[model samples]
Target: MISKNVNSLIKVSILSSLSIFSAPLFATEKTIPELVDAVNGTLDTESREAGKKVKLRNHAKGFCTSGVFKPSAKINNALAIPLFNQAEIGVIARFSLGGTNPHASDKGAGRFMSLKIDGNNESLNFVTTNSQVFFASDIDDFFTFQTKVKQGAEGKQWLIDNKPDAKAFFEHIDQMLPSSSFANSAYFGVNSFLFNTYDNQITAGRWIFEPVEEKSTLSQVQLAHLTDDFLKEELLTRIKAKPAMWNVYIKFAEEGDSIDDPTILWPESRQHLLVGEVIINGSRDDEAATLQCEKSIFNPVQLPKGIAPSADPILNARAPAYIESFIRRL
Candidate 1:
């Protein structure tokens, strides 16, 4: 019989390779303000019953951690330049649950991980999720998806009207199982980015953060008994025991791959580069740290030299929404 750990590994691998969920639906053209408003509207509608808390429009609830990013041994690739060329820079990271509910259960369907690398001139920020694929393709589809989700009965009708998008959304949700600890899970950047070398060589790719330790999932019994703040508590305990680490890799897209659409996953055979490692030294669970993390914006669009976002419309729309969220919270 297969061992329990082996069974768990198999389950995770299968979930990672699950088929792409949604196709890119026709999106109506929208300005940045319009898109940001739609996103805030969804968050406001969802949080109506939760009472008055400064709800984060997305990745609303999180715990902060202090760490350092050590670059790879040699800088053979373009992407490695930013982290490796400089001294080991301090990093502030936030691990969060997906959605607007600060009191969301630890067993909720989605999780988020974001990191900001502190630098002298400009900082680099990367935001990733537990799943490799996103539910929508562009700003338009994102607005539609969020609007439908907030509409209740009307949302159900909208999903029925947009059958493929609905199917994809649920399929994506099916794979986002709760993990036993934040350090035990892998995170992915669903959107593609353009990596430019000093020599002007350009390549398209996505980011993946693989935990050094094997991932472990909570049993159904454990999940059912978890506290509302279980994820944060678990991370605190784990850090005290040992530093959590993740190897950073970028999967490069080949000619035919869809760089602009995040809903599609690149093939497993795609080439990947090990650019660096992220080591979490301690948890930033104090009230001051929590406030700093919550108030600071972590937008994927905030890139340093040598790295830029792809033409994915959804990618382009992220900054404005983040800016709007930041201002309103302050």
Candidate 2:
């Protein structure tokens, strides 16, 4: 019999993965501003009856407001040079709550940060969260995780069996997801890009970013309201006061290493090396210019050298999804 702890973890992993759904499969060729207009327009049309509670707690700063997801404008070329080795690139980050419910609050319990880093030659996109392990393995599983949650277990297996790589991925699901979340689970690109690195073949991976701060659960009493600009107010307050640093690292899969399997786990025994620290000095854009900085996209596959992506199907799906979404939105 499975232990209660393990069973709980399994539920969290699967549930979370499903909630982080809706990848752009096929997007139209639209400009970024046009995309934004449409997306925001759709958001306005959403049914927001119950006031959504979004809590954001920074060091010293108390929780407040639903973090607003806005358009990124500035491209910090100088910072990119040191970290990604790219001279210049365009990027955008769309922040949102992970769920199918259109009425999800901007300040939901969990949040997602999608970054698109444009390389001089290529680009990379990363979608990450506070939790380490994802609910689903790939885009399809992403949907399956949701179906099972809404439909049932038998329904999930049925969908998987119909897919070509079903058995292999399904067999790996047990190992891919722990009954509970990893002491802290993480996300990698799980796909590869063309790089000078030899292992770039048949291998793809995702990047993981952990908060230097420890996890101390916040209760309803800890929650507060900051209106809409909660994230901006909090993040800015922290940066304005002291230099906030986050360790950034990569975890990769090797050639012929199930590049298509999004759930495949790369060993931490191969611990991700520290690339660098992201120091948020101040706004990379001026007040009037903040608009441009917000519109840019920060994709993951946008590698320079030593860093690259794997040739995974997940990568294939993301390539078009992000580009089209960005093209239309940006």
Candidate 3:
């Protein structure tokens, strides 16, 4: 989405930072700042394309809701995090479409569920998406893909031609139908994390919020009749009548499973445990809360304790990128 003018500006900005990317090409040793720059550049390009005020780099169109997280009995044995040990935790969540344009049509766009579990001393966040696997596995690959996308159709075609995984991911996204409500769709966490038990046994796992409600999808006729901003309205009306819920499941990683590469999915046969449940009761009324949800970056790396991030380069690179994106809007 970069115009020639923005493209030239970015080239000038990154000229001095070439070495930062060069040294990390193979090792996936991308620094936080470098990743931040890459993310901000993409956001700038996207904002210019949208012809709108600066907003989130992605998932810009979303709504915030207040809720409570009830820990399942299984959670105590699964992870050693004290936050989860609590009976209930105050939670704030945002459901959004996957795009830089805040006012774009929601149809066919990817969805995101970002949740923050507020605890006494520390807070945990899960920035989940409606996909089992991501497009890129490492920082270098993600950066390259972002760069390619900025080049427009030809650059995306390069990915389809050369990168099989990226090709498959794009195909998956293309086939995804629009859900009638956010409450009906499942949300998957792309990155894997280590669940350290109090007994000192560590297990690698990823999480998914499986909807407690029946799944619903929009028919072609219905989709044709609805407006672009129907989702927020539907969700707001739905929540007023009844809360939406999801059962949290931790998919345990088996031996030989790819722990670091988020682009790879673990076998369906892998054991999964129901560790908790999320109940979004109502939309936030406070303007400050709304603004915070809209503006603040939900950094997944911000952990409480007992849980640790895997060696996934893409996972580690997210925080810095999100921080940069957050800073640019302010």
Instruction: Write one digit per residue (lDDT tens) for candidate 3, span 1-330.
Output: 346686466545544444354354347666554564454444355544443244436676788877889989777765688888788887888998876667978676477899888788888899999888698987777877766776779988999998877897989887888888888899999899999876889999998899999887787888999999988888878888999999999899999999999999898899998888999886444546544676566879888888899988888777755654544544
Ranking of all candidate structures by their lDDT, best first:
3, 1, 2
Query: Considering summed lDDT, which 10 consecutive residues are worst modelled in model 2?
Result: 51-60
- Alpha-carbon runs more than 4 Å astray in model 1: 1-27, 42-56, 77-83, 153-157, 160-163, 283-291
* Model 1 poorest 10 in a row by lDDT: 17-26
Listed in order, each prediction's TM-score against the native is: 0.82, 0.51, 0.85
User: Between which residue pairs do clashes occur in model 3?
Assistant: none
For candidate 1, write residues 195-258 as lDDT tens digits.
Answer: 8755668999999999998988776787778776888877877888898899999899999999
Relative to the true structure, how large is the alpha-carbon lDDT of every model? Answer: 0.73, 0.41, 0.78
Candidate 3's C-alpha runs over 4 A off are 1-56, 287-291
Angstrom error of the Cα, residue 170, model 1: value is 1.5
lDDT of 3 at 175: 81
Ranking by TM-score: 3, 1, 2
The per-candidate count of clashes, in order, stands at: 1, 56, 0
